[model samples]
Every structure is written in structure tokens, then in C-alpha cells.
Target: MRHQPFETWLLFDDPLTPDQARALDEHLRACETCRALGHSWRSVASLFQASPDLEPAPGFANRWKARLVQEDQGVLTARYRWQSWITLILIANGVSLLGMLLGMTFFDTFDSLTEILLVLVYRLTSLLTVINIFQNLLAILIRTIPGLLSPSGWAILALIVSSGSLLWVLSMARLARMPGRA
Candidate 1:
């Protein structure tokens, strides 16, 4: 009635001793359940052996990989778009809040709209005055700098700069070429 060794022997690929094989054959003859199991197992194994190995068509792997990448890119693009929308909305809200706060403060401090306009004009005038001062200074420097240096002086300055650059380059090259430095 016990089917332990006989079932294991029939199902497994382990080789059986002559005595074990004889005992298994005797058990198979008497045990209908084990005999049917063994028969089905052999039939399934034969089916597997007779069938050809299935392979994908050419470029199938490449197509599948490309599809995966495309899906990932779609997901990333949507995420980026969502983030961009959120950022734009937040920035708009912040600008609106700042404008409202500044307007309220300015209205509370100033008596009239004309005062606000005058203050804006004064600030713009100050900024423009500073810019104009810098522009005039730049113009003066541009006019006087060339007069300060003769042609030979300019050539000497260029030579000095080029020699310094060449020295730096040669030092770097030597450092790079030194062994055990990497």
C-alpha cells in the first residue's frame, strides 16, 4: 500500500539499482494509481522532447526593450509636465500674493496715488543716474586707457600675458606627465 520509494523512483531522473527497478516494476503492476502517474509523466516528458524550442522572431528583444524605454519616457514626460505646471502655479500665486501685500503696504503708507507715482519716478531716476555715472566713467576709461599705453607698451603687455600662459601650460603638462600622479 505504501508508495514512497516507488513514486520517488518513477518521478525522479536518478538511476535505479537492478533490485530497486525490480521492486518498482512489481509495485507498478499492483498499484493502479502509481502506474497511471508514471504513464502520464512519461507521456508529458515525450511531448516535451518531441517539441521544438520556441524562439522569438528576429529583433523581438530589441522591439520589447524599445517599447519599455518609450513607456518609461512617457511616464517621465508626464511627471515633468505635472511638476512644471505645479511650479508655474506656485510662482504665479507667489507673485500675486507679493503684489497684493506690496499694494496694501504702499496704500497704507502713502496718502494718494500721486505719491506712489512720484516715489516710483524718484527710484527710477536714482537708478538711471547711477547707470549714467557708470557709463560716463566707462567712457572716460576707454578714452584714457589707450592714451596711457603706447603701441610698444601694449605689445610688451601682450608678450608678458602670453609667456605667463605658456609657463602655466607647460607646468600643467609636466605635472600630468609625471608618473604615479593619477
Candidate 2:
């Protein structure tokens, strides 16, 4: 049986059936591209096996466990900060909407339709404000988190934030550049 080029290379990593293995072997023998690919895969696998495995210093695991705890605490603290901000924003918006409704009803102002429209506008504005505030607070917290100053901590934080930002930007750019929703 014949196999496609990718399948031939893929079989190198698995327990191939006798016929599959024979097919791949024949293909590699005749095709320089497949042969080179097989050789490269073997070279990578051999290097991984031959590399030295270094044991960590005494108490290394304990130290790592302690660091992990610290990182976890930092993450919890960050989450709490954001949660508090969101709660506050939500409460404030809810109160504002309640007050607006009370004021409108007590004063007996505007027709029913006008009152409904005004309330809708007020709700939308409040929602936008809450989102804006939350984003700003989150940015500030990410920038100020103290653990981020450590080399490893900074790398971890940067990797997380940068990848998130890159993905957001890429998605937005893709949307903007698309021909149409279709």
C-alpha cells in the first residue's frame, strides 16, 4: 500500500504495521525528501536521549514549592483586586440606575416612551463606564503587581500578558482586514 509523504514521516514516531512500515521504508529509500525528513527526526530523537540530565541542588524541590505558593498567593491577590473593583462598579451602576428611576417616577416627567428611551441611554452609559473602569483598573494592577519584579516572575507575567495582548490585537486586526462577515 502507498502512503502520502506526511503519513510516511508520521509513522516514524509510532508502532507501524508491517505493511505500513515496509511501505515507508520503500518510500524513504526512493525519495530523498522523505529520507532527509526521516534522518532529521532520528537526529532530534537521538539528541534528546543523549542530553545530560542534571539533578537539582539539595532542597531544590522545597524551594520551588515555596515559590509556587508565593506565585499562587500573588495570583489570588490579583484576582481579589479585580473582583473588588468589578463589584464596586456594579454596585455603583445599580444604585445610579435605581436613583434615576426613582427620580423620574417621583417627578412624573416625560411621556412613557421618552422615559423608557432615557432609561435605556442611562443604562448603556453606565455599562460602558463600568467596562472602561474595569479595564483601567486591571491594567494598573498588572503593572503594579510586585512579584512581577523578580526575573522569573517578570518572564511569566510578560509571557502571559504579551501573548494575551498579541492575540487580542491579531484578532482585532484580522476582523478589521476581513472582506466582509458574509
Q: Which candidate is the best by lDDT?
A: 1
The TM-score between candidate 1 and the true structure equals 0.49
lDDT of each: 0.96, 0.83
TM-score of 2: 0.33
Clashes of each: 0, 0
- TM-score, every prediction: 0.49, 0.33
True-vs-predicted CA distance for residue 3, candidate 2, Å: 23
lDDT of 2 by residue, 34-140 (tens): 67766788898899999998988899999999999999989989999999999999999999999999997756865677787888899999999999999999999
Task: Tell me which residue pairs clash in candidate 2.
Answer: none
Q: What is every candidate's alpha-carbon RMSD to the true fold?
A: 8.7, 27.5
Tell me model 1's lDDT, rounded to 2 decimals. Answer: 0.96
